[model samples]
Target: MKLSSGTIRLIIPAASLALLLAAVFYMQPRAMSYTGLNLLFNLAIPIALATIAQMLIMSINDLDLSMGTFVSFCACVAATVLQTSPLLGALIFIGAIAVYAGMGMLIHVRDLPSIVVTLGMSFVWGGLAVLLLPSPGGTAPTWARAIMTAKPPLVPMAIIASILIAAVTHYIVMRSSFGVLMRGTGGNDRSVERAGWSVIGIRAATYALAGLFAIFAGIALVGLTTSADANIALRYTLLSIAGVILGGGEFVGGKVSPIGAVIGALTLTLAGSFLSFMRISPDWQIGAQGAILIVVLALRLALNRLEKREKHQ
Candidate 1:
């Protein structure tokens, strides 16, 4: 039976989720009872934030390779401020994210290629993180740790928070004029500019959004770990992008479903969980994620080609 595109998309996610649950039940029934929920929340929240950050940048035909660096820097800085007061540290964390956003905006305004500029900015941010903490051994406040680790009854606060953030973002991107313009700008910056809109401004906005999302990821990491380190954001750079692409973000050059990205993030986390629970070596996970990404990317390319062929026919 032939399947509609919508049906196919639905099937992918449903199948993925079912397999994940099956693996958990098969491999770690006992441990899954106690910490399974926490582990899933832990993985989903950070990946969701990272995917959102990548999605925002992709909305304007840009990418933020500096996400990892920004996350590490922000978290490390937050740790320092938390040393004094958790409240004050949260404030500083937001401020630091704004600083990164401003830097990205300035780069866009100056007509620098987003990838190149962000790559450089990553190093600069990493250096700043190193200077601030030198390594990853700083204590987060008791309040921060509690917020990150606690699992409230009847409502997984972390999961609820993730859903809320995703919903708000989806609403803004789908229902607002800014969203329309971003989708337009992402499709073709030159055409958008010719229509009398400032591509610079739009691109700057995208970068700012990306930076804000990265800050969210940073805070989540700090909450989970109760400590800050310079290398904290490194892996997220690839993982977030992989999540975005896997979730159909590449269909329109990055204007993807925030929900889909969340689902993709969950899938990745689940995959890792399944592997680890099965006593799969850590090295295998790296290889497995890469293979999964390659398969997704190839599928995207094939779909694009088919679409193009149909248009010509």
Candidate 2:
């Protein structure tokens, strides 16, 4: 029996992940201890969140180039507000919600291309981040830090929390009406709109979801880094996009897979870890990831063509 196109698309990345695991074990030549597991957890959590943020927007056939910059903005602002008061810090988080919501509305109303809008927003938000903290060196209040760092004594609760959140998020997206509508929008917004759904509203919701994910990502980063800095969110914009593409999500939108995005995040985190363990330089990572993504994109296109041709036959 033949597989569906979506199943075919996921195969390569799944196999690539299995191969990545093999490479790690072969290179390490050692059993993975609790410490090693913990290290992986640390790498996985933020990256997974970042990937989810990107995936949310991609699901609606929109791009959010400002995600990293927004995340940095959230972190910097949260740090500043916490210094004043926890209530203020909470307000700033809500403000991020508002900021992103407004931006989403702008995109929907202006009908500007998502990539253009988000890229410009990235610079704007990044500038705000600089203005907020200048050069970093601010501390998140101890209370905020403690809550993020707090873990169940018996287990790596941070990892557990992330997994549970990802699971529930996946379930909601897969089992809900919103999920079906969003998927329909992704596949063909025009057709979906003909069916009486508002494409703009769905798209805006996607960006809002992305913004929430960024907020959570920012908090996680604060816990991990213990300080807010400028340019913190910059790298994530590209990295998250790369992760989504690598996970078999179409760069052009109309397809979103939470599990695929998670696997993609895992692939990136493990690849970076393997490279670091081998003493490879950081500069090489971007090139390596780009090459991998290009290959995946090409394979997806080739597979898509094959499916179309077979159907025609």
Candidate 3:
């Protein structure tokens, strides 16, 4: 079967996921069952959400170093305040989203680097998270627990949730008119501004969306863990960045594939499981993850070159 370069690109992420999942299942045959699959992938929902959140930020050629700490803060709120005072907790979430939107404007107006801004905000978020959970213990709300534990007839909730996120995000980001403006803002801000669009407003709204999804990721993490800690999602920063790159997203140019990002999350989850099955130590696993990310990045660059060569053909 002859496949065009475009078709090959589309299948690469899925192919990688299938291979990773197969390797993990081969390592532990018992995990081939439905219950085992659920156990293996349930936590991926939060990671997938986080990856999408990071993708949104990257779509504007910006990196969000605060994503992990901000998610940790939200998870702390969901576990403690959300359970006790729902309205107040909801307001806090909204305020956090507003803060993210405001940051976008602040960075735009000041002509500052997003990495530096978000990196500083990371410390701010980490401080608030520590304050929220000094001792590292709080119960997830009842509804959150129920929703996280829900099991449909055939498919696992993780798969269902990831698919939903991918589909909805793909539409909003890749198809809609609003999406074009957002990408254009990143690709050529001067052109976008000349077209009569408010670049600041568009940036703020996109950052707000990123904040909202990161909140979802935090809530989902708390739901799965049934508790909260100050550093619950610290590793998510690197994982989110790795997933975006593995999923065919570029650092700039506003290029992204929502489905590819979700598949990347799934692949990362399976890779973790494979490592666990092989009894790798936590420290070593961290090193291994870094190596894997480097390899993926190299592979992506090679693929990009191939695609470019084909275009020139």
Instruction: Find the candidate with the highest TM-score and give its number.
Output: 3
Flag the better candidate by lDDT, 2 or 3.
3
TM-score of each: 0.84, 0.86, 0.95
Q: How would you encode candidate 1's per-residue C-alpha lDDT over 120-182 as one tens digit per residue?
A: 988998998999898668877666677777777856666676778678888867678888788
Native-vs-model 1 lDDT?
A: 0.73
**Residue-wise C-alpha lDDT for candidate 3, range 183-220, written one tens digit per residue:** 88878888899989999999998999999999999999
Worst 10 residues of 3 by lDDT: 1-10
Candidate 2, residues 86-147, lDDT tens digits: the string is 78878777777777767777877887788998889888888989998998778876765776
Tell me how many clashing residue pairs each candidate has.
0, 1, 0
Clashing pairs in 3: none
TM-score of 3: 0.95
In order, what is each prediction's RMSD in angstroms?
3.4, 2.9, 1.8
Which wins on TM-score, candidate 1 or candidate 3? 3
- Supply candidate 2's per-residue lDDT for 200: 76
